[model samples]
Target: MTTTTAFTIAADGSYAARLAGEGDALYAERWTLAGPEAYAVPLPLAQPEEADSEVLPLADGRVLIHRRVAERHAFALLYPTGAETGPSTGELQLGGVEVREGVRVRLLPPCPAGTGAFALAAEDTVTTVWQVTGDPSGPRPVARIPGRCSGGVWLDRAGRLLALDRELEGITKAVAVDLASAGVSPLLQITEDSDDRLLLADPDSGLLLIRSDAPGTARLGWGVLGSSLPVRFPECLARTGEARPFAVQPGQSLMPETCGVALRLPEGDIGLWRPADRQVFRLAAPTGWLGGSGLWSAQGRLHLPYATPEVSCGMVGLDLPVSPPPPVVLESPTPTAPRPVPLQQAPLAGR
Candidate 1:
């Protein structure tokens, strides 16, 4: 089976980077998705990359790969040297920083601007964010956040603000890190005691998909930035076996409720939902799908990338059926003086 962990697409959905191999022979592969048809351009060096090596695609048609080499994590940009063909050769642009020993580093999600890439290096009590590329100079540390952090989500189109779930003490909360000043501020605090995480955020629409146990159990919910309205935990999102929201439709600035959300279900199926519709339409996943990887166009079409035996690079676009909007309804809260900060909205799948 193909290793799914290293598969990643660019923020703009123009390219993809993945590790394609079995057992111990793993090599980095880049897929160009902006053309009429998808094609893979292999980037294999003299030796194979480690099995656990992580790769991310940049908007400039280069692939950034992170590899662990005895006590240090190295970063580099890979690109094809000649025309795309079998046994293609690639050159590694070595300009990233070599992380210190004993530090665990991982690449964050692609920045919204698609020009820069970032990663978190966590030590004992602090995590540092590094700008690996997109700058004239070499890699440098941008932010030093207190406590261990994970789950990176860019909050602005300029890539100025990043949201990360921090774990200090025993609780976890999502906080926004301002890249300019390295300032940290609370972004989500549903309750005094809750593990809240920001799963995904759309810079265009200010729509945030969050996962938190503020409602007793961990459930997926949605909230808007700079909005006083409480977060809504619609029942349609409470599904079994890890329903992760991966892609959010762009260009829905004033209609966050109408934005298309593509979810990866437990059984590797795709779940399409919109806050206004309040229902999840299930769709079958393409074979050899890089799970939890896809992109949504403003036109309501979801493009999923996949690789199969006969076809090396392929992508499929899915269009959801249209339905009229339902009446605005709210779920009744239990009889209490103060309702939950995030009102539990009524079940939305079937109403």
Candidate 2:
């Protein structure tokens, strides 16, 4: 099995990952998401500087990749060749298009209406909407967001682009863009200095989940389209004393799938809240200093990037079961064993 450098889980719960170890060799691996691993198909790009690649699974089973070559970036559509061999080779459906100049592509939403491709964010600062056509090499731009955009989502069932714009006045406003018409319109305008982060939207319900810090603490709020006032979840409270919200995620495994919000407390503890049932879970002080932390993945996974006495820098993954009421702090079932490094004998000692 090849060593994986980075990986992401597909919407279908399968895994599409890239591996690169010594010698800068690159290989793409696809596997099942379920625990017990299965066969893997490896494709070799085989380049010294082949770093930073994104694998986006298409609705039709083909995977779209944005790989960096030389100093430029290109898009490739990869699929099974139906032959059993090394480096599952496939045709290059596209090449030589700059998705976002200077910055790597961050997120790629699924294609919609067979008319538009997807939108890509550069360093989470600049956003550009790309139209993926049958001719892969000819992906054209639909719209370019002017400033830094965050909390992006494809709102409608048709996947219309929706995002929160962080304005110059330090205000975050909800904005929507029509991909077909290239029309940008402001959906909700927030005046408070609180960090108004967009969570998720249910097209069927027209209910937009948002996290806002107004009461000197982060709180869960929900509102529908054309509505300026948001109904705040009175039960959910921020454990963090900083009056800021760090992360907000919608419960996936729950019966109805409620919203879970995490707050970074000043004392370094993390407070998790479920807005639907008004339940709170608290994780004690992190194992180490809390440089930063968040709900890192779409799945129920929390990643804390911190420094330890032994390890200068590392990310610890907390394995907690996903249920109606998720656990706040995860306890490792087995203790991590330490490896000792042998010291070399001194020349003076030998003499």
Candidate 3:
């Protein structure tokens, strides 16, 4: 069966996802949401194995695709040609960092404000962070944190702050890294025993979705950023299908209560998550199709991609309502909120 892999959507609503193509070769397909259409990008010529390659959509409707040669990672910018042949090559740039055998390298997404600033991480013993500013040069090395590093999600659109989970002294802790100062600070908490696993956070929304063991279960946890008082996502999280969040819409980023995640249901449906009210909206898909997370457009439309049992796939453009429809009028089951999880009591005096 043709399985879907990692997917990413551009700011301009272009969608890209990896999937099985002609024969046994894996290829990345680009989608133009307007037509709800999909097509495969050109496969690499030099190293057709597609080793360590990735396709990331750019703001200008093109794609920055990685093509590896001799274990070195290189990139090519592809321009859409709207034909079944393939995307035409536009520009090429070699990655600055060398590929270490076991070390993992990642190209972080740019800030959501379309700031053209992003980060590249080279992970080994110590985490080396590089700030890429679209300069003619390349990614400029910035912070190097000790121990292991992960969960590298941007916290601010300014590219001034980032949130990552790390092990410092053998204890796992989630902390924020200041892009400007390279200083790391531990995120505060609502209780003493709270072990926060920072998932994805939005500074503008002041809303952070995390995983914690507070309620004796490692379920979704959420709270305002600086408030530091994260609460368990209410025992009645009222969700399934393991949704992946999409980009926040413009002008609505600062709204603390709003957010969205594209979920894949077991019965082959696209589930939309607005956790503020524990809402899940399921949109049915064609039979035998599986869908992935999507991108939120400025026009309040969601562009999602789906994979079929065959090599080809499809895209869907979902229009979000400007105003909430009365719950009683809707067909989707209403999400119910249970009583909030009880907070842990403070430690008495001292041990």
lDDT against the true structure, each candidate: 0.80, 0.48, 0.54
- 281-311 per-residue lDDT for model 1 (tens digits): 8988999787568989889899998878888
Ordered from best to worst TM-score, the candidate numbers read: 1, 3, 2
Indicate the worst ten consecutive residues by lDDT in candidate 2. 338-347
Cα lDDT of model 3 by residue, 237-319, tens digit: 43553444444444344444555544455566666555454456678754444334566665556665666656355655786
Please give the range of 10 consecutive residues that has the lowest summed lDDT in model 3.
330-339
Residues 245-335 of candidate 2 have per-residue lDDT tens digits of 4544423322113444455666667765544444456676456533333433445465544434564333455533344654332111112
Query: What lDDT does model 3 reach?
Result: 0.54
RMSD each, Å: 5.9, 15.7, 7.4
TM-score quality measure for candidate 3: 0.71
Deviation in Å, model 1, residue 73 alpha carbon:
0.9
Q: List the residue pairs that clash in candidate 1.
A: none
Q: How many residue pairs clash in all the candidates, one count each?
A: 0, 1, 0
Q: In model 1, where is the ten-residue run with the lowest total lDDT?
A: 331-340
